[model samples]
Target: MQNFLDDNFLLHNDIAEDLFHNYAKSQPIIDYHNHLSPQEVAENKKFENLTQAWLYGDHYKWRAMRANGIDEHYITGQASDKEKFLKWAETVPYTVRNPLYHWTHLELQRYFGITELLSPKTAENIYEQASAQLQAETHSTRDLLQQMNVKVICTTDDPIDSLIHHQTFAQEQSSFQMFPAFRPDKAMQTEQPQVFNTYIDKLAEVSNREISDFQTYLDALKARHDFFATQGCCVSDHGLSHLYADDYTEDEVAQIFQKIRKQELITTEECNKFKSAMLVYFAEWDHEKGWVQQYHVGAFRNTNSRKFNELGADTGWDSIGDFKQGEALVRFLDRLDKENKLAKTILYNLNAVDNDLFAAMTGNFNDGSVVGKIQFGSAWWFHDQLDGMTKQINALSNIGLISRFIGMLTDSRSFLSFPRHEYFRRLLCNIFAEDIQKGLIPNDIPWIGSMIADICYHNAKNYFPFNDSAV
Candidate 1:
């Protein structure tokens, strides 16, 4: 049998190997969307141990560990770091068919140069070696990023954020730039009146204005948007259950906002109207500033109230949502396109069933201003694995121009996660190689390899307005 994780780990043929090695592997990553801490980059913090680096804050690992019947103490509970790691080691082999299996070994191999499969017997040595390396200055957060050839990172941030860490990186002229992407999810969360009001208070403090009315609220958010623009932010991201395009008059939205400010409970219809208005307003600002807007839709979050109450959100309690998407999504885009107010947009659906729908939906509004004006985004969240990526790539290739597709993002909270980009590249190159080998396409390696390189790097470099040269 073939050895585990050799140089040709995901490559199945000669052409696939060559394409990945020559074209895809060495391309600098532009992770245009992620949740990495900018503060960690600025401070260049060293991970204290393997667990701190690998386990802590990684809900992906937590989910897998739980699936393997590992206990809470070994995950996010009171166990020591080494104990938690040992538990993870015992769970790794059991994850054989899961994406976690590949991701685990890839991260270990890429970051620590450990080719041996992780198991209970090997965990101690591996942990010692990696933890020792992590303690070194050369393996600090910033150094880790540099070693991985990460060119630019756009961290998801609330509009009210000061972006001080990003400013710090800019002032120092660091090798890699960390720009913030505007995520105004809290701004549109009118259902949680008290929480939203608290957020507004913070926004008011940052903007030096009171938000007593809907117009004032919009003005406050616009001020933050302009502030973000000044900091080289060219992207806006929304994490939504689904697209919202409920019809409402300006007066209705105004009244809704007023009622919310008073902490009154709004009906589902009213909530949708308010959210819809905010979405359009955000899109308008994006268009006005020539920025790209990305929507991550259909996440049914906080499913386990018991777990959510104990651990909070993004702690592995979320799952794919089956919300009705087409009507509202189409209406939203059409509303913007008809008015010539739609920005360069990317749509990501957590539910893979919507892959074809999103692909076709994007086609309806590519109004010739840009080559790929509207894009079906890469597979995200629950769909970032091999099967999901293949489906997304094929769907885009079938119905849209995959040539102009801006590719993968980490969307991870770990410094060690950049290897995921390499994972995607290998999978991508393998697909093209197979297509060429099967006589489905020309036996032209060079032409196909160029396309691979574009998907891996050039497409994103050309698509985003972020200054890569500055980094």
Candidate 2:
């Protein structure tokens, strides 16, 4: 059979094909946000085979298997590699309309030169061939990343991590830059004060200081933030279901932390006060440093406690939250904007109801200093799909200029998922191609191609100055 990756699958749109081959092929990937381990990139680890890379860490497959009534033993349990591949193969035919279908085929075609469809019938041949290539040094972790043209990556890290890998990777690879984001979710773990206190003690030990007071706690976390900065990190990330922006006096906040430290059952109002102050303080610092701050709001995490403990967090146990996110978030951002301390911000929403709200909110703080000083980030996590991407794109376009849009990121734990960018680029090209075909955009190939390149590559480069080349 002929290779599916041959000239035949180049593209349906003549202009799209030309643009990808001519321009997009050479531009390196700037994966600004991801959950990849810096240690793997630093050490340049080699995978055992294709299944370990594709199946071992991919929770997407786990979700699909659970939905198909496959036991956890087959999904991620003690199943052999071939057995896992067999199970995955059996499930593939039913994955139509899911992004996995496109991602699996796209990777096979683009990376492995595979022409045959992946199914129970072709499972053995496909696994054997892919496994063989995986044995070569060319398929090592760093090599895999280079193959995807990844030039820079920012890993989501907690405030407590050592970040030794980030420092080592920086000294070793000038070609690819890996940085850390100072995520302090546990610091705000007010729901579990005991856990929060334990985390604080560990943080204090790491920072080599006593965090007896709230200021000391801030200093300790800020010390790590400064340490992150030395290794070329210019971004901070926060994940919240909604903003906590109620104003509080310094006395009230101090008492709140006192109650937290004392392990007393604090009122919801006290928790809100502490969280609000902490959020404001972080926003102020991020603005002071001229960093890009990301807020991923509207995720209701840890919905199933049993699955959470058995399978651990982020195992498809999170759901869409429906808190009153609008007025509070707008008030918070408005405060920052009023004080001119609102750093370049990116807002991501899980609920589609807030798409228009986020879009309009982004434009509200634009200030006209840059084309995209404020942005509603690409649909993330469960929303990184055709419909989600389209709604987000249309929302941003309707409110602001689509030409200035920054494109997609993996938001994945899997290494092979870099093809997500290709998925996004193709979707973008098709959108533009359809527009041109209908005369909504002119038939000028170069102009439309340039627009496509902007969204896929150049715009993100310009928007985030932390892209390796910018560094």
RMSD in order of candidates = 1.1, 2.3
Best by lDDT: 1
lDDT of 2 by residue, 205-295 (tens): 9999999888898899888878777777788889998988998988898888888899888888888888898888888888888888999
lDDT of 1 at 312: 92
Per-residue lDDT of 1-471 in model 1, one digit per residue for the tens? 556778887898999999999989999899999999989988889999999988888988899999999989889999999999999999999989788899999988888888889999999999999999999877899988988899899999999989998888778866788889999999999878899889989999999998889999999999999999999999999999999999989999999988988899999999999999999999999999999999999999999999999989889999999999999998999999999999999999899998999999999999888878898999998888999999999999999998889999999999989988998998998898898889998988788889888988888888888774743
The Cα error of candidate 1 at residue 466, in Å, is 1.3
Weakest ten-residue segment in model 1 by summed lDDT: 462-471
Off by more than 4 A, model 2: 1-12, 23-25, 467-471
**Which residue runs does candidate 1 get wrong by more than 4 Å?**
none
TM-score for each prediction? 0.98, 0.94
Poorest stretch of ten by lDDT in candidate 2: 1-10
Clashing pairs in 1: none
